[model samples]
Target: MLRTDEILSTIQMLHAEHLDVRTVTMGVNIQDCASADVEAMCRKLRHKLTSRASRLVETCDRVGGKYGLKVTNKRLAISPVAHLLSGHDLNAAVAVAKTLDQAAAEVRVDLIGGFSALVHKGISSGDKVVIDALPAVLSQTQRLCASVNAASRRAGINMDAVRLLGEQIKAIAEATADRQGFGAAKLVVFANIPEDNPFMAGAYLGDGEPEVVINVGVSGPGVVSSALKRRLELEPNLTLGELAEEIKLTAFRVTRAGELIGREVATELGIPFGIVDLSLAPTPEIGDSVGEILQLLGLDAIGAPGSTAAVALLNDAVKKGGAFASSSVGGLSGAFIPVSEDAALADAATRGHLTLEKLEAMTSVCSVGLDMIAIPGDTPAETIAAIMADELAIGVINNKTTAVRLIPVPGKKAGDRVDFGGLFGSAPVMPVRNPGASSRFVRFGGRIPAPIQSLSN
Candidate 1:
């Protein structure tokens, strides 16, 4: 039970600080909706999604209002669409995607995830079909989000799938050229992707999850930063280790608030409460930026030296606090440094202070990898594959989740600005150092064997 003082503190956070539940995602298993006939499968899928998620948005709003908390997004994550595409072709995949879009619209959810394929080791026939259909599937749909897990700790990296996704990302860019290749922004290429993440475009109902579950994502970089600023103002002599402890305490309160909301939602929906994702997911809004937290940690700029260590400190403190607050903590529960989504990070990139190399280094310690980054449109497919390989290798070796959401804006060159608008934000197209140099390396398509750590029993 929260003390009276604690309750008032939370109220202050809600009203003043940018502290609110980021997303309340409900995962719905759709494997039972599959059928051998394409039309039958689509019909079943549509019915299942509609029946399951019809009340999601309403319930989220109702419960959030009950607590005076705003649930920014109500989302749905279904089982991997590749499983539903068994014995299907590209046409079937597109049809299924359209069905998903229609169902999501009818249910009034913000985004519908799980138009995804998990081919970490090898691509199944269905996985290949989904990959081939992505350019059309993503371009033609608004609310549909997709992901492809091309690497894992045990199975290592699937260079073949990586190469395919890189090629298709370019195709997706061309298909949505009028929208500045915004379709690519809806797709993520992941390594060691978690099964229970509440965030998109990487969320899916993994095989081990329940038939239906509610997961909450709590994001408050601003709240964290404010707490740190207040502490420094009050006690300027505090050491870095003491400052980290303060962060943990603030995160504990945030996670408790999120869990309270999630459990209430789950109970109302008659589903199991899954987990609370304690990611410090930032936005384009000022003061609500992960980069600002790094600045508070004394970094001259986000990409300056010691930035990686600073991020590691913040990520670790957040995780420790969330874990202690909730035993069910899961998902990517750390700092997310999506470039365009965070105003400070976007500015850093625009000013050339944060290069792709520095961002990659930072991802080694952050929650996600190379997120919301806009690159030159003409960047080579091979080069894109190489980028994925390098980032995924970090996750594979470290045994953690990492993903890439690279948007190659069509017709835009380095230093040009591409505006995606809304929470997607805008960014200057950063240059890729070696445009076509990785062609041969990425073409050697095979698995990069798992690191020695995988041998642990």
Candidate 2:
């Protein structure tokens, strides 16, 4: 703990590799804010959120500045809005969403998550309200994010919920077509969704969590890549096993740094520190890509034969490092490969080096599934459901977290470019090999039984 060289090395790496905490997310349990009356419920939501998170931004900045670190985003996640919307109608759902946007804006947070529904087994009335209102909710709100859990190991997959979400995603895109389907980017469909995820579109305060908590997302694909590159420069013949060890060490430092900052912020805010999500979340920025790390790991192309294995190695090393660094490592603590958000992956997709099928295979190993990938607007709802069914099947069978964040850009076709700009980035729409071929399969809609793994005692 007293090694000056280690401290200096950490400092150097922070600046040199563009390392910074990705997000400081404050989770507030708002289940107490529920009411049958729409206006009263919205009022409670506003008061609860504002009172709980008013100082989140200020605290993140002050704490980060103390350590010469930058907290890229200060965000908020509430308990599932579905609970608050129970016994409410679609209009009430819209009202709750608007209230969230307003409250988050007033508190000056970047995004507000937890507009979510857990429909893994079946959709409750509240879940239905949230689902039905998504097209309007997403189209009209800027800072609001939503998630729907349609699959889980214990409950199998809710094909009904999946089919609804597939259709609604199209509706959401057409509702916001003027913005090139950017609204769909704010939604994530999940299997075995995490309660404390600090990442956007999927974050929410799950049941049994504390009343209020602070979670941090430390994303360092760039940092990991830089360390690998430096090591390779010195010894060009190091084996993949050796490289994974290096990744673990680098992840250890990153996780420690993240937890340090997150705990400090939590202490200042008078709430418990939740976890450090050590996911290697990437951006469109050059040098800050997960795909670049894959390239550095001797993959000539991202979606080649060895891509899945490389991702598995990276994801495993990261989890091991984070687990060793902190007992508080939760959320999706692995390497992310969101296509549009990672420039290298996006370029690989544009160049035909990556395809939907390849991306699905990699998600079997990576942290998240089919993230930020755009497809033709004309893609069938049944096909979208099939895509989700396949990814969720992976999670349900393996008992891990996997999600889909696909955008079907209106009026766009496969191979056409759709620029969402900013961190949402852009991608050339990838073709769904057989658009409506899966209609019958997805149409035979019933729960896909959970694997025998669910019975493990």
Candidate 3:
């Protein structure tokens, strides 16, 4: 099973393309950390997390250095704390979030997800607690992130949960207004959310997953963009299909590198390896932008006329390449178009080249939806629900995962700038027309039926 030349070639391709493993997320099921007594539960939660994830970030860095690859974030995901704190009050639920944040800091991980609730059908007592605590928990916590799954292909959309989350989002923004509504940055509302996703603001240790597992998120926007550039220069008349094939091949190599590193790290830590999430997650950096990749695909700008088709091609090629690379590939492994997180996207939004509607259109073909988008503080909650409903409808109809992380900058208007700093970046608050008039539609609280695709045997 040894091939020296093949290994060397893989390394060369990685180095040349500027590809690297984006994150090594360890999912630690903390359902067992729950107890009838609050103090006992906190103790169990701390002990389990510290024991399982004590060396996660450190080991990831060590492994990355050893392979001459960079591991950008080492993260942890736990079971939905809402379910664990069902009998507890909102204060108790917030305490659980605090424990998660402290544990994450002790482990030195960048972020800890799973302050979550899955209320696609109906809300539970724990779900209410978590939802109510979101304003405080998000504003108070440092590294903890939260996600709420309000819709699924099988269960349809929960209009009640959607409406509530819309209000909760506003509250969260108001609670952290002084910090640019940074609390909203840590929360995401999703449709058809993936369980084993290694990405933040959404990743959660699903009930079906093992006690502890390693999930890798591999990113390669730069790699694919560079490959396309070289191919375009070499064959000026190459078809779009040929260009996509080249991108797929490059993604295959990148996925291979991720799988190899993930397995090694899992084996060394004596834990089960979950899957390789081959999402082309971009950063605020120049060359690493997914919007830049779209520009390379001949688009005049990121949100131009042919932008949706270009995204469709890029997402399809990335999935095909990742699927070919490893049988263990899972999670939302497609192109992410977060406006604030990608420099080019932020520029486009600031220059009025990209709008909220165009971003929604692109999310239909891409992985995540309306990510890191900032809007006016006065944008009505009903408008947020309408936005979430539109994206979730796309996910339900297509049977894909889509999510929203909208930041409503307090006291800020469309032209105002909100800086979240670091990986979240900064963006001009985009305008949303007719921010009212959706409340009546949202108030008819019932589930949106699943699409025909869910009838599969």
Backbone collisions counted per model = 0, 0, 0
**Model 3 whole-model lDDT (C-alpha atoms):** 0.90
Better of 1 and 2 by lDDT: 2
Query: Order of candidates by TM-score, top first?
Result: 2, 1, 3
Please, what are the lDDT tens digits per residue for candidate 1 over residues 1-457?
Answer: 6799877878878877899999999999999988889899989988988998878889989988998988999899998999988789889999999999999999988898999999999999889889999999999999999999999999999999999999999999999999999999999999998889999888888889999999999999989998999899998888889989999998998998899999999999899999999999998999899999988899877799999999999999999999999999999999999998999999999888899999999999989999989999999999999999999998998888999999988999999998899988878999999799999999999999888964655
lDDT of 3 at 390: 88
lDDT of 2 by residue, 379-454 (tens): 9999998999999998888889999999999999999998998988878999889889999988888888877954
Residue 409's lDDT within candidate 3 is 90
Candidate 3 deviant stretches above 4 angstroms: 1-17, 454-457
Clashing pairs for model 3 are none
Task: Score residue 234 of candidate 1 by CA lDDT.
Answer: 96
Off by over 4 Å in 2: 1-4, 454-457
Q: Which candidate comes out best when scored by lDDT?
A: 2
Model 1 CA deviation exceeding 4 Å by range? 1-4, 454-457
Candidate 1: residue 406 Cα off by (Å):
0.4
| Predictions in order: lDDT | 0.92, 0.93, 0.90
